[model samples]
Target: MDRKRVNACIEEIVKARKADGGLKQVFWVAAGGSNGGFFPAQYFMDRESKSLRSQSFTSNEFFLAPPSSLGKNSLVILCSMRGTAETCDAASLAKERGATTIALYIEESKLTEVCDYSFAYESISYDETEASEMNASYGLFLAMVLLKKLENYEHFDLAIESFSVLDRVYRDAWNYTLPLAKKWAERNKNESVIWVLAGGPAYGAGYIFSICNLEEMQWISSPTVNTCEFVHGPFECTDKNLPMFILISEGRTRPADERVLAFLKKHTDQNIYVLDAKELGLSRIDKRVSEYFNHLLFSPILNNVYLRALAIAKNHDYHYRRYMWQEKY
Candidate 1:
């Protein structure tokens, strides 16, 4: 684990936050990589508090909610790996509109100047989790700490306990996923894209996991399809050669997994990578409690690990900041 880098990043966020007043009354905004996991971490703070909210936007894009309750009482804590135009534009807008801007990015580029305070993790290096992966994990944990300090949640102890379980789940899951990742690397066979399917709590996870375009190791496009949408339209076109990867996490959305698997079976010709939760063999089920949080938190952790392993399997350097050149929006 890059604890030194992680600790430094956490300390930077805390220090920058202190300089900008404090995080107790701020909106932690994140898009792109951490959008899946860290966003939920921010959202963990009860919505009624008027102190926290996570802004989620379209793929390859970042959005600013119309200046509502956020202008006066809130500051913007934006996270981006590459510091692309989408993130830069959003941060610029937030800063312009009187929001104290704080950025958690991998490289200190344009965003560093635009933001009032910037915490760039210069130590994480290229062949690791980079931006999204690290940001997601850190974002959630940081959000929890901030919320506990500010918000008056009675179940704080339980929440923290549950949160601690997430790391073990990811580590356990990686054990099983490593072999699958290797298989995906050895047998990709020039496949251009990988379709990831999920809905409910895993819906957001599916979206982020599917859209890992920032990593340059594999030109593999990951598009998340609505479980129902696949049955209606994309299912007909998919064949054995064109495979899709489905994320099956256990929860209320378990039924969606069955439907997705059934559909895949019907289209047996297409290559299918089923990233099931059981296969991951996570150590604790407590981490699996929140469909929303787990998908965002755990999935990215798994992704960062896989991204590193995949890069190694293919002998390529892995860095999100370097891949920023190709991001158009």
Candidate 2:
């Protein structure tokens, strides 16, 4: 929560990139939930910025098959809650290749030491306490600031101002959504399989919820598929008793989500839980900016909080794991 330090670090990055032929590309490098958090930022840059090309890669893949686009004018951002070995190796490689490296971590470790710039946020921890939502928010803020500096984005000020009151928004969202989450958990506690669907930036939320929370934490069968890709093959698996969760983004691809929702409703007698970003009252945020960035701000927190409630209802602990931190990979 050291806003001043974060600002200073971003300022230095901006200054350095400006001096080094004006930052041609940005790579968000990490793995698992950490890499999932970067998706919204990549989506934002793709939609809003013209000059800066943004992409995300898992640490293992980046280390084995380095991108041809990575070079002196590239800004590489690596994130890890615990600063895992793969992340550290990837950061070291990117640094050695002359890319400007920034490490965002919850705790100090080897990855932090290898980067040109490092940021540690005490409020965002690498645990099963539903804190990854806050971590994603911080990630989006850092990405937005970088984009603002590079492109002079018109809506950056409003976005930052809105985020200043995000604590209150988060509280309100939890209060409003917790009851619904609990109800869904109670009803579906015995279900064997679940399908999660999302499109656009909200895909990150779906990925983390299905993979990190449901599958990894609760040991459930939850396969996340993009709404646009549902009809290709995944949609055929739907049945009357199956459970589905849909995360609807408020951006350009919302119509695609709506199309899938309508199809599911018409074809299946199963329960379909829809958590739409438009329902959250982001009172302080501008409507235009909210439409574009609300998925990054709202979806992860909602899904994280909902998954916590599901864990409770299923008589499972969110922190319980078979191999995650209990054994070495």
Candidate 3:
């Protein structure tokens, strides 16, 4: 990631602020896995920003019907792994609307070219860099930097301090989760549906794990529900034999997740595979802002370690798609 470019882009936006106002709203626009990756950012800005509001939009939705509030005072961050058509079009529309656009993508393509600012958070050589850098981490960092500039976010320094030890936290998570993920794969390799539950900052990890890793990559049936909302109606599906993968976030909403877990543990069989931030050595980062890093800590374990093991157990290639890239949808 080019920290200098990111700083410069946000700096320019703040410097050119019109006398009328500063930034008012932010639109996190993307599709599929990329859209899910923005959830942490949406959650962060939703909680942190006092002068600004934030919303997430699937790419075509933004292209077809962007918010009326999307004007010069708005900022739109669009992401796509390969710069897909829908996302590129959304970036174009955002640019046409006179909003400052930031494109987060792994490679340069049409979307990057059209947006006002572009950051390649990861590249072909991303694996050679720190284990902490991830697509979701980029989204969160953008929010952190923007908030630091606008509101002088109280925990800003602590947040940056958190980043420094993320590679450490990530390594610890991997070492701890490796044996557990292997066991998870062996357990759930044959299950038809493995429900995933999480909320708050950790929601994105669950989203990507369910939709992107399990369904899209593994061809498994995995539906996700926010932990806080599971009790409202989804609780009816609970059964002793039902398999679940519950991720516990360290944020304020953790109690809500705990409530969901408590009910599931009693009603369901011992099939609830769990990963908690408290289990990982995330204490190296300050607790004050540790919530923001939960997804980052959970991501590689979910997508890289667990799902890859599941793929091997099922004798399926993670990159193989029966329908997706093979056809023109």
Index of the highest-lDDT prediction: 3
Mind giving the per-residue lDDT tens digits that candidate 2 earns over 58-151? 9999999999878888889999988889999999999888898988887889988889887765333223333323556667777778777777
**Per-model TM values vs. the true structure:** 0.69, 0.91, 0.96
- Greater TM-score among 2 and 3 belongs to 3
User: Arrange candidates by lDDT, highest first: which order?
Assistant: 3, 2, 1
Candidate 1 lDDT, 49-92, residue by residue in tens: 45545454432343544446444335566777767666777777
Question: How many steric clashes does model 3 contain?
Answer: 1
lDDT of 3 by residue, 94-159 (tens): 888889898888878999889888777663123454644667778888898899888899998888
Off by over 4 Å in 2: 122-133, 296-300
lDDT over C-alpha atoms for residue 270 of model 2: 65
Pairs of colliding residues, candidate 3: 240-269
What are the lDDT figures for the candidates, one per model?
A: 0.58, 0.78, 0.84
What lDDT does model 2 reach?
A: 0.78
Identify the superior model by lDDT, candidate 2 or candidate 3. Answer: 3
